[model samples]
Target: MEIKYIEKVKKAFEMVHTKKPLVHHITNYVTVNDCANITLAIGASPIMADDIREVEAITSISSALVLNIGTLNERTVQAMLAAGEKANKLEIPVVFDPVGAGASELRNRTTEQILEKVQLSVLRGNMSEIRFIAGLEASTKGVDASDADINSGLAAGCSISETIAKKYGCVAAITGETDIVSDGQHTLLLENGTKLLSGITGTGCMCTSLIGSFCGATEDFLVAAAGGILCMGIAGEAAAEKVGKEGSGSLHKAIIDSVSNMNAEIFTKRAKIHEA
Candidate 1:
């Protein structure tokens, strides 16, 4: 079973580098640069077009679309809807990042609108965001995830993720110290990341882009999302080892370098994924 998952993950990475799938993104301006850089770092081409006029056209030509609501507004919201609708029509996978879903009423309402309108392939968010989207009690500090221990450990997170996945009919991934990915029936518990990852500003946004790249390469949303999360976790640990005492500045650059230099050997050796 481990070998099967390893092979699938390796193939997804190879296809991204070899096929170079084009991923269309309707993301916020705050982490737009990081999103594009991470997409390229993972050997996938990214086209960032949030303009409503061209979003439909851009999504039509891409293999996958990523819709992120980090810095949400009316205009970008419209663009996201247009791009998502087009992607649905083309039968391309769509990865959604519901950033800051519990931060404000505007964000909450907008997220609800997107979920109601678009049929997502994967929904990725932090614990607070996912809980809020699931209509559970949760507190968020801006876009960052607050310290949470609802019913303890990853099991609690898995239950909530499974519920959301079943509701949306898509793969749901809740990322934190121990990332959890679920497809309503099967739940995955992945432990492979560093504390330094929380210091980065756009790591979550970049994660969505990487997941979009993986989804573009394969039809299995579950494996694709797991591969993306695992890649980030392993790359984070590798970058931390290289940075030594340089702190967040060097750690950020090293992460991109790690992703660019990532191979099957490193991933297969370092990945820590389990069926929950």
Candidate 2:
């Protein structure tokens, strides 16, 4: 990317600290705590509330809303719809993570329901999940991308990301060995993460949270999406360097620490983003 684009991302990253925006999430229980912590680490407040009675109230008070279908249930699905509608009426940015989208009928149905009801600012997922959302052949192995799908490479990812962005009318971010962020008109390829990032659960959820944090602080969803992905990618690299042989347990803590310590200078210098 050009220096100007990098500067735009840096400004979005710093605005998270300046605004300390409140991000409301109606996410699955599996990664809720880690999601909240990662949001805080990036200087945004997280309120994870899914009670149908209170979801609308919570979303109304927040700057951004994140909806994740990681662990889907009938009740939470209803809450997600209610909260999403409220967020839409208020013009709050919504980030949707279609976790395990192609794994089962329930997930696929829920993904479609959310897309029909909510106007997402950014739609982020793994290559398999995004491909599934784009109505393509996707092999999703219970919330994880199949090896064959992961090996599809950047060219395929860029096309799918753009297709989804145009179809959904939002920024589409497909995260993998190479993360692709596109808003139809412009696409960015980011290569800054570690393979070790896949060793742990909730990293993808955390990445979505980071994106929501940046989205909460800025109206430019494209830059906000890129900034958030870049933050998680850089943090993973930093954590991998520190953990060394200690394994995923240590890397988990170090990842949060790196996110908490991330600054504009570090983000700008270390980001491996390019325009496509």
Candidate 3:
């Protein structure tokens, strides 16, 4: 899975540890614990709150902001807007995760609202989520990909992603066996990951959280996006290597362990990103 773009991603891995940052999140409950734990493991502090009163205060103080629509509700939606607006005004970077975006009418509308309300720095999600955000027809299961080509089935999902990024002026990242990231111009392809990632719940959500973690430290939106994807990929590979056969549970822990030990030397030796 080794590739040339690995070096670029590796340098970003080194920067994060040297400059620990604060990441504030207003995500769902399903993966909130893992998201927070992973953020901390990746050398960043995570604070998740949807309280309308505190969201603005917290966003104003954090290094990065994350908004996830995994478990959306009227009350929480309002909170997201409040937090995201403050993050915007304060100029802190924001990462948006449109989890299960095409799963329902409510989800689709909510995702659009988020984009309209906040100027996102990065949009990390599956093809279905990205496609839905791009104003294209898409379908999805509850928080997961539905049909296995255009939405969630394509080999390289950047076609829809590129269009979406340009429309919003943000980086769009679509993950699968190979990951695709583009700002409607340069697209980065990453190849470091394992099938075991799909066997775990909340991994995608955690990946988005890690993006915010890295963005907190480095304002380079592209590097922050690339670093999160490759670092998580590298960690998953390392975790699988360290815990050979115990199963996905052990592999998940190893992934976190690898992130806690993330560095350029380790990443450069393990990353697998390349030009698409």
lDDT of predicted model 1: 0.90
Highest-scoring model, lDDT: 2
Evaluate all candidate structures by whole-model CA lDDT and list the values in order.
Answer: 0.90, 0.93, 0.82
User: What is the per-residue lDDT of model 1 for residues 7-96, given as tens digits with 9 covering 90 to 100?
Assistant: 888988898888899999988898899889989999999999988899999999999999999888899989998888889999999999
Cα RMSD to native, each candidate?
Answer: 1.2, 0.8, 2.2
> Which residue pairs clash in candidate 1?
none
Candidate 1, which segments miss by more than 4 Å at Cα? 149-152
Clashing pairs in 2: none
Report the lDDT of model 2 for residue 247: 88
lDDT of 2 by residue, 145-249 (tens): 999889887888999999999998999999998899999999998889999999899999999999999999999999999999999999999999999479899
A best-first ranking of the candidates according to their lDDT comes to 2, 1, 3
Best by TM-score: 2
Instruction: Give lDDT: candidate 1, residue 240.
Output: 95
Error of 2 at 74 (Å): 0.5
Candidate 3 residue 79 Cα shift, in angstroms, is 0.7
Residue 220 in model 1: shift from native, Å?
0.4
Task: Give the TM-score comparing model 3 with the true structure, all chains together.
Answer: 0.93
Return the TM-score for each candidate structure: 0.97, 0.99, 0.93
Those runs of model 2 whose alpha carbons end farther than 4 Å from true positions after fitting are none
